[model samples]
Target: MQKVDILAIGAHPDDVELGCGGTIAKMIAAGKTVAIVDLTRGELGTRGTDLTRAEEAAKASEILKVSARENLEMKDGFLQNSEEYQLKIVKMIRKYQPTIVFSNAIDDRHPDHAKAHKLVSDACFLAGLPKIETVLDGQPQTAWRPKQIFSYIQWKNITPDFVVDISGFIDKKIEACLAYKTQFYDPGSKEPMTPIATKDFLESLTYRAQDLGRLSGVEFAEGFTTEKLLAFKNFDGIVL
Candidate 1:
């Protein structure tokens, strides 16, 4: 029943934060509504438990100012681009009726990330199909599809189709990311360490934004890839 201007779907708890937190912050700061759908609790992650991830996710969502956030509770690391999974995501897409949807990169080192990309992309397309009925809270849901689907970049160095300028939002993005207390570096925590979700990882998040910003001539930015080519309606967009 919640309305949102944009909906970002991720394969795991922190993927959205790592991938598009700055963009999301920019959107929210501009008064555009936003939401997040975490496909899984990241139970299979190397560092945190499901309960801990959920709590951290909540904190991050609050910092992001998203209108809504939900976890599909799907199996982590074992997702499949199947009809059943697609239907579940479709249901959410219709329920939220977001105007723009952001999903994971189509190809990634994480098999689950690729699967999530396919699932969300298919669901976004199918959400517009009038015949594919979806129900929510015992009532039939109306068909709706997002106008645009942007895939956020991940671990891979795939060339981005475009980048979002997050110059003023770098701090906000980091704040949201640190909400995942158990995932990132906490010098005081006794939890085991991992390659990602560490202090160095957190530092990289900032520098990554700086790197992308330099390429786009912005103070900070986030990169994204698109399934189809990007287009602008006017010649002004072509101006230097």
Candidate 2:
């Protein structure tokens, strides 16, 4: 099993790219190993087939240079908080054994996003129970729980608990996001326009980061909310 420092889980393929790709890029650049898990292949999307989405996800993973990327193939619009779904995530948590998990937003415009947030949050807690019993690759997997779970902001202006200064990596994030050509704003394509495909949404990616940065004293940044209170080892990590 490939151990990583961080595991980012999303409801759909480009969710991570749109939400925390800059943060992921910055962390990986700092030598932190990171993996991505898409809960769904986004088969119900207005544009792009499942194959196309999978291909785009692969390209986005390459752009971010993540250690690994996997899809759970969950139902696109209907996410459940059932044990079966929880165990699937448990297997991944055990397989990667990451300390930090980045999950979907607590609340968002998309119903699936909120559902995913609770599902992943519960799985993280359940993964720590020894009796859960998970097996990977025909071998019994040990129980593992992440130290922290942070929910990335998406499709809403929810207040953030903290923000990561992703100034230098915003371009990398945008590149990864645009990798899903069928999903985002593409003027040349004749596909039907969705909320995200609008030109305004494309520009919002940058302006939103800049706005968050403006509030937090950075050139650009990504915001996340945590269920647990965050503690700092020292003030040295804080940017002035």
lDDT of each: 0.88, 0.96
* Model 2 ranges with Cα > 4 A deviation: none
Candidate 1 structure quality by residue, lDDT tens digits, 1-240:
788899999999989988999999988988999989999999988777999999999999989888889999999989988888999999899988998899998788899988898899989999999999888999999999888899998877767888899888889888988888787888898878877756677798889889988888877888898877767887673314
**Model 1, CA-based lDDT:** 0.88
Q: Output the worst ten-in-a-row residue range by lDDT, candidate 2.
A: 230-239
Question: Candidate 1 — which residues are off by over 4 angstroms?
Answer: 235-239
Worst 10-residue lDDT window, candidate 1:
231-240
Global fold similarity of model 2 (TM-score): 0.99
Residue pairs that clash (backbone atoms under 3 angstroms), model 2: none
Prediction-by-prediction clash tally: 0, 0
Query: Could you report the Cα RMSD, in angstroms, for every candidate shown?
Result: 1.6, 0.5
Q: Residue 10 in candidate 1 has what lDDT?
A: 97
